[model samples]
Target: MESPPSVEIISSSFIKPKFISEEANKPVYLSPWDLAMMSTHYIQKGLLYALPKTQDFSITAFLDDLKHSLSDTLTHFYPLAARLSTVKQQNPPSFTMFIDPNNSPGARFIHSSVNLTIAGILTPTDVPITVQSFFDHHKAISHDGTKLSLLSVQVTELIDGIFIGCSVNHMVADGSSFWHFFNSWSEVFRSGTITRPPVTKRWVPPGPDPIITLPFASGDEVIERPNYPLGLRVRIFHFSSDSLAKLKAKVNSECNTSKISTLQALAALVWRCMTRARRLLPEQETTCGMAADNRKRLSPPLPETYFGTSLHSVKATTTAGKLLHHSNAWAAWRLHQSVVNHDDKVVQEFVNSWLEKPLVYTMSRYFDASCVHIGSSPRFDMYGNKFNLGNGLAVLSGYANKFDGKVTVYPGRESGGSMDLEICMLSKNMKAFESDEEFMSVVTY
Candidate 1:
């Protein structure tokens, strides 16, 4: 990433906004029905790299400039500064809140230091190994506010390679919204003003009245825990377009189906892989859930411009006997039906139930479950544009999902004419699928 020229910060007119208070705003209670989707752990972060155009590039200079521009832009987004709050004992409704540093809603922390290392520059490395890391590495979940570590700035070059790594927090934004924010940020830096305004449409989380009955009793009912280490492994698979087409053809032929998006196909393929991985002694079934953004499904479709946490979830389950022997197309067709039926109310209802559950209780159920999976759409324009920082553009966001012992799928490169799909599963699951010649053929294709 090319560093920007230094500019004077004379006559600063910066003023940070304060988070909303219970005294000022009404407390919205969570219901039990909202729990299905809300019980999972949610942590998002991103690593954006500005690939180099020329071998000659400077890291320190580029990051210093990016920080200046970013800080200025973030000053306008107040949610980053706000803290989380829930209703206390419901009489007239009072908020029970603990302003934890990690849970703060608004711009909680900024990158405090910069760490840089270059690897595989002159080596026989075939692909760029973007080893992006985060700051405030050690964060403990606390009820009370605690000072947290911040990644003030990070800029690194890989030996003779050209790329700068940038990572950011999830509370600030999701992948799609953050990408929009970054595009605007880049536009502002280049044009001195954003060409497009941010999406400001309000997302009505499950309404406050009727007290959405969540599945759980209270927040105390849901359990939250860090993901198990080494239990899950992450890998990226790129399929040749021809192979993708052949697989799609096979799926269509086997299922007597029409064109199905690669995502739906992969979901079916993954479900089969995981269920078959169990090497079961008896027939069993498991649920597979997909994260659907209902921003466009509301009575009034949510503003594409509206920014906030706007998402709904849908789940599908397959009996071990059915998935184990089902043709790829058959499972894919069933999976597609389940996802299409997921709507805003379903999502909101799930969230309500999630919020009402005791954290511990929810966590335990999640950990004990044999089948659970959730992932987002790869709909954003990530690898399309080249962001030139006198070097190259890099992608960034907060989806550090370690799919521990679960089946997960996200968007990948295009397969056929549809969006390509990225599928992740536990290592054991991967091995199991690979062991099945037929299953492996379906996936590898």
Candidate 2:
């Protein structure tokens, strides 16, 4: 086996936004979700983009541009450049939040170059795809309750392309907030200004609503982290348009009811296959959890461009044998129904359910082996965010998923109807998972 590509940091600097006023340093209160997220130093979300060739933008020139644009963009998105911590008090505090000060620490930006190319690594060949090796691994997930830089950008120059990886703290922003900053930064990179200004203030509950609380005592956190360290494996699975359609049609037929979305069908298929691989009991309760974006779904809706975590998670649960024994459609319908249940009334109820209590969520925190999480929506332009590079986006992957049974979905590299599944599982489960004939039948790559 060959070693994966390595990243050598050429230059590391702190880029403080040019516009942060003294008042911008005022302590910022954290949302309930923020506190819950801080409990486990869950690995930061990573994005690897292979940029097209550029004649004018040399590796140095590109890094120069990235640094300047990112700094400018962070001005409007200042909280990103701020630190995630609690107000220091002699008596200790109940909640942790962002520490703000004029000279507070800024995001860490590293300029790196790798002796690899997008073609060599991304395209499968003799060696298996060890994508996690080519990313900013340690700085992203190594949290010991100190040094809370909200964002870290590592721009590596590859032989034939540019490898851009972002390690963003979940408490800093969820998918919505992360993408909002990304889009604005891209706009600043290409157009010198952003179109949609950010709405950084958080959304609060209605009048008379009780204050929400969350447990955040680090080591004693209720996070569903692995009880013991286990070696993990990462693999990329592809689903072609034709195969997805056929599976969707078959699912709808078996469901014997109204149609469900392709995502639901896909989730059900993967969940069932994984459940069968685990060989859980017929009565064992297994869950499939997916997050719902509440940008526009919640009452009154969030701002036109809310730059914070606004995700509401919903799960479909069933007995292991019950889910496995039924037709794929039955499982698909369960997934769809879970999403359907995230209605306006349920959205409010979700908030109320966490009042004066811990804000528990299912993502990387599902403690048991019976849980399977459906990650990053396929609807997200994961691979389509163009940097205005000539050849455009060639591929996209979240590269650093460490949790077992967690799958992150992305758009296929080639185009329409194609999908990429990055499945992270323990070595044992992953070994058995790859050989599962039922899953291999529909996979295109």
Candidate 3:
């Protein structure tokens, strides 16, 4: 590990909007299961880069200063950073929630800090500099500040570039919320003032209100047969423009099908592709878990100020053979049925009931169970138009972990009569997808 920069703090302050006032009304405690679910994803890192040579800021100091500056915003979302602070051992067991349960909630966000490291890059000039790695090296599995470290001194280099990696708990904030924090941090650093207001609406803790829970389970499948991976896998491929055009045209023109979104068509194709990869029989049901942003879809559009958690998941299934047999028309219709009006109560109930069952005993039993976790956000294209991260800079994207054979399908360019499809799958599945002439021809132009 490398040390952080030695930079002076100009001025740093959080922009807490009027909407977040209510969420601060009380400290919320998530179930140990929810915290564990959140912690698992923290292992999947989100990274971005910064190239600021003129500023007196060192990568190390910038991170240290930023961590101190953003303490207010950090405390506001205490559950995310602090909850993982109590870990005593490396990658502690599931039952051990990280943060000290008895610690005052006020101490929550304040404990969070930014760490740094240095990696060499190919460059013409000879400069030695360090980079900021926000995550704790020791607390790879937990979220403790001490486990988290700071480079004792400033780091400088010839390249004049730094990479910032964020390991925030997804349960605390999605990419959207995370971007808001980033933009605010940039604003405070650049101008020494919090110019823009908080992007999140006031937080509303879901009261004993009857509603859905996350990680919606279906069947006794997840529990009855927990499929642990026999080995790790990776694959990659580039979808050409021509191939995407032809596929969209075929799916759009399929009989008995009206206009179908590229997402649905791609989802079907991905399921088919995964089935092909596993060589599953058409009669066997395969599930692709889809992630949805319930923001606008939720009634009253869920408070803009309300932050906490604001998304949910839905699962759809079909026999591999049955899906394979379908013409574009039938598959599109089936895909539409699974996702359209997903906000409806019936769909929510369908997902929640499956997860509520006490299946710890069952979930522990299986390994190598096949599942495709799919998440695609239309917002990825919009460069912070609404969230307003400053300087016209935004990283508008999110994805499920490469584990569990995930697929993310979102809107693509309009080709022929349909929009282009962007499909991201685990590396291995991607290779299988690219080699499938049938799959490639239809989607490409």
lDDT per residue (tens digit) for residues 174-252 in model 3: 5455555555545554554554444333333345732223332221122222232334343222245455455556677
What local lDDT score does residue 133 receive in model 3, on the 0 to 100 scale? 24
Write one digit per residue (lDDT tens) for candidate 1, span 109-132: 332222232233212211122332
Candidate 1 matches the true fold with a TM-score of: 0.69
Q: What TM-score, to 2 decimals, does candidate 2 have? A: 0.86
Error of 3 at 428 (Å): 6.9
Please report the candidate that would top TM-score against the real structure.
Answer: 2
- Candidate 3 Cα errors over 4 Å, as ranges: 1-25, 31-39, 43-45, 50-57, 75-81, 84-161, 179-231, 235-249, 255-259, 347-369, 381-400, 408-431, 439-445
If scored against the real structure, what TM-score would every candidate get?
0.69, 0.86, 0.60
Of 2 and 3, the candidate ranking higher by lDDT: 2
For 45-94, candidate 2 gives per-residue lDDT tens digits of: 44455555455656667778888999999888888787655433333334
Quantify all predictions' global Cα lDDT against the true fold. 0.45, 0.68, 0.41
Clashes of each: 65, 0, 45
RMSD of 2: 3.5
